[model samples]
Target: MPVRTSPADAPLRIAVVADSDTRWKWGALTARRIAGRPPELAGFLLRGRATPTPRQLAEVGVAADALREVTMAEFLRAAEREPYDVVVLALVGGAAQAALHGLARLWPGHARRPVLVTGYVGVVYEKLADGLLLRHGADVVLANSRHDAERFRAVYEGVGADAAAVTEAALPFLGGAPHTPEPGRDTVVFAAQPSVPESRADRMYLLRRLIGHARRHPERDVLLKLRSKPGEHTTHIEEQPYQKLARSLDPPPNFRLVYGNMGEVLDRTDLLVTVSSTAALESLHRSVPTAVLTDLGVREALGNHHFIGSGCLASWDQLDAGHRPSPDPRWLAAQGVAPGEAYEGAFDAVRARLAELLARPALAPVSPYYTPVTAPGYLPGILARHHLAPDGTPLPGAAPETEATGVRRLVRDAVRDAARGAYRHGVQRVAPVIRRMGEL
Candidate 1:
């Protein structure tokens, strides 16, 4: 396949559309890693329920050449108007599918279109088939590990969809100095997830155990690495925030809540613990002694089940007894955590694939597996939720609005915050009460 090489005067122009803080970090970092050269990178934050605030963006700390927020329709319009060589859809499956169809419609038959890329932010433990099918049309669907790439291809091939799109690549944000044991102060960082243990009781139990561990090891620093503040949203809705729950408990002086880059925290970390956060992969990549808690069982719902054979699973009791589990070398390699040269070349294949796609004169239209024809009963609703028509056009009153300013912008911000607060309340408080009432 012929590879397109941009002229010396012109750098590759790449666009990344992402929702939520985690996806933004993944998308922005991935763009830079795959650019090969210092490409002109543009970032568009999908303005919706999970859009990260400025504070969240700062905490994640990944930056682009230019960054702005856009609705789905606005993004499609921008893609049509701009000359981006590659467009990464760093969004949820449904949003990605909608964008794929929309782009296909806008650049119909023999028209030049950007090389589309889509993928998960981390471990895929649920909706495997559903998510893969939704992302089927992209030029590349990145898999953070060889294990994920294999599974992604199998799902596509099993359903008779093209599996060539599945590309094996390591997580872009997985680089840091190798772990070195800190003298005197052994820091134990428990990476908290937004919704792994969805129930309040479960979250509280984990918090109590963390407190117990801190008490047991008074000389050590026990940090709860929280994802977001109470009012902020993330990739998943955080119902029972550890911050709120921690306020109710009397934790030791050594025990404290922390918010910052996970990599920075891992710099001093002797042990990294989590139910299941992508932070585990980052920790493993840096050779930090890591543990996936088995106190809550290796259940699929909790996502720790993905690490069942990783050899990193241990109970809090085991950790308390100074048992630092070492991950299986084979498991680490398979999960794209290979050391030295092997890890460095993890994205080679995908980069080559992107170059080849870019070289094509007139690429084929985006053809996702789930269309109005293939999934008549399902696809429309998904599109409609994003205010998109089945054909990928924005619905009435859904066209991109001009950027609001001054009083109007303030009102919009206020309204959005209130809505998010209400949603969090429903998830944390009302839903549990309803469930209890149903049980009664």
Candidate 2:
């Protein structure tokens, strides 16, 4: 069916809440293209606790009216005030997904509610359970590849989501015109993410290995790309900063920690190494030689499993010997990242889907009903981590708790808190150099 709006009708409104740089660029570019100079296009820079800096906004080409900085709560209240036709979310983080659930519950059965469209902003391996939960909250789930779309559908159906909710959409590559390698500047950048449990120990190992490689091949400049600055908050709180970690080790003359303008860095980079970073996909799209570090095993949480059997990933042994890996065409195609293909189809699909949704605003299904044992007034503390009890006073107990159950709960909390404290202590104590190295 055709979109209800004509050229003369009011321009469609879109609200984008981005959690990261890549997702922000994706939303901005897609919204800009779809909106096409007709009128104002509003969006949100939802960076959790961190606000978007002017430098960050300039880098992403986000204009003043194009995107406003807002918290999840503020964004939801705004959605209530002047309803948008669609809301594009970079629902990659836990808090973001949880916020979506909160919004869903808040606006139950609202016929004019905006449709939520989300996708994987990076590698997906063990996150299927979380992805399913996200699907439960969203109206449409965008898949990064045809393979991913199928995978999402199976998971959604398994979780009893509507069959029409999932759709195929390629991950957008906003870097215009892939660059060829410049002669005499052989830069090898290791895109690091230390927040993943599997990568914590292995990340340091890989860095030492990279140092060894850099020492052996002094002609090549090695750069360690970090995610965030020390003491800054990201979606996932990084335990150890690689900068602090690297400070303890003797430095190689050719190696340095590099940050900022990831796309520009990739343009000048000849070889890129990482552990399941979406940057690998971007590198592949740019025809840069890229490798997924397999030092960490293919556990679901580590997300290295996605690269198994794909030639794009290199083993620790392989990278240790200075072997550069190329992405297998078949594997790349399966991941829906083959070159020269129209990556913009995903944006087109989003636009079309939004148009359809706007035409029939009430098409999205209401969530399945559930009966809570506790009353709504007393449920905020249990249901929400961020939402507090009334005036900071604890809510009345839903039911009398047994001694055994209370003790068990206390024990669980104690253990969890202790483990978290130990991890944080290790990270803080070991803060010599080379701290968290991935998101930025």
Candidate 3:
């Protein structure tokens, strides 16, 4: 018999995967930074940009010449030859994972590989409701705050992620600036909008809070604006209560409504107010006050950091009950975090993780597909999620990322009687050809 070399079963392959969108840059940039770190990790980078620059790549503190940028297709083919070390799917949209898993069909032997996933839990702690639903993709989670870490641990283990095996890393450095603001201004300006609202009533309730806040404070003028995030349309903003409140209010406009040219506009603004906004950190470093408002009964997920105090953000009732109106100095300590320094620290932590994962012995993927999803080989729902077609009209000019995937196929399955029915009489021996097909 011809020997089967078992090339499909080998050491883990480490690849940084991401969508084609602009955010993919985060993973690539971070991976590049890691590749340029310590010597042990430099070897595991295997493929990605060599940190620093082409000229600076040589001085990356170690020898790492083999690493280079790779397309998703190229990666799928390469994994067929050797197992991967890790696949970091940084911050990517849901559609990206579908394509990544579909591409996994090209190489079918990595079912048990480790996947480090990072994304919001999409949990909305409304003022008076329980954390509505548990979210996934936070499976192997990397959370920055204590609440997020605890909540995620509860979520993943609830879904069976060998919580013991999962490593929880404290990510003090993962935070980002919402925007730069004027110095020494203590006034609070809230810039926030929840992407997904569970219901219209909940949405309107939050809106009324903002409007009520603005209306009650005869002095302090509040500004309500939407951050200019990519793929967000003004129409989406126009549909919100911010617009409706604008139409409803009489002449004494306490709140200023803003929509476009946000970055420039934010430069002149002071304190930022909202619910656990990444922007609050930006306001902090800029010497502006930030108050994270927790509606009526919602849990305040954004807690006070060692550098920033809880005072920045307040609950709606607290505003009514009267609390000391002062910004937390803890955040002032955060003023020390330089833009470049935080990025460097983040890169260092990531490199350390890569080094630890790659130095260990290799193992075959749980299945031939290193990506998410339980089964491989002619799996349905998995590939169908990719949302691509042979023609690209839905996506405009370019060709579809995927073609006709066809029907799902099954390799093998075992059955047992759940109903206590007449199993002995209902079951029968398979015919010769049918038995042969099963063997085949």
Which one is best on lDDT? 1
Distance from true location, Cα of 315 in model 2, Å: 3.1
Q: What number of backbone clashes does candidate 3 have, counting pairs of residues 3 or more apart or in separate chains?
A: 30
Q: What is the TM-score of each candidate against the true structure?
A: 0.95, 0.77, 0.48
Query: If ranked by TM-score, best first, what sequence of candidates would result?
Result: 1, 2, 3
In angstroms, the error of model 3 at 374 is: 6.5
What tens digits encode model 1's per-residue C-alpha lDDT throughout 1-440? Answer: 12345684477888999989999999888887788877899999988878998999999898888998888888888888788888999999888988888888787676677899999899999999999999989989999998999999999999999998899998988888888775686999999999989888889999999999999999999999999887788988876788988988999999989999988999999999999998998999989999999998999999999998899999999998999999998999999985556778888988899888877887887888988889999999988988899888888877646778999989988997799778878876787779889989
**In lDDT terms, how accurate is model 1?**
0.88
| Model 2 vs. true fold: TM | 0.77
| Residues 177-231 of candidate 2: C-alpha lDDT, one tens digit per residue | 5758777898988887747543446657877887877887899999988766664
Q: Could you tell me the TM-score of candidate 3?
A: 0.48
Q: What lDDT tens digits, residue by residue, belong to model 3 across residues 58-78?
A: 322223324543333444444
> RMSD of model 3, in Å?
16.8
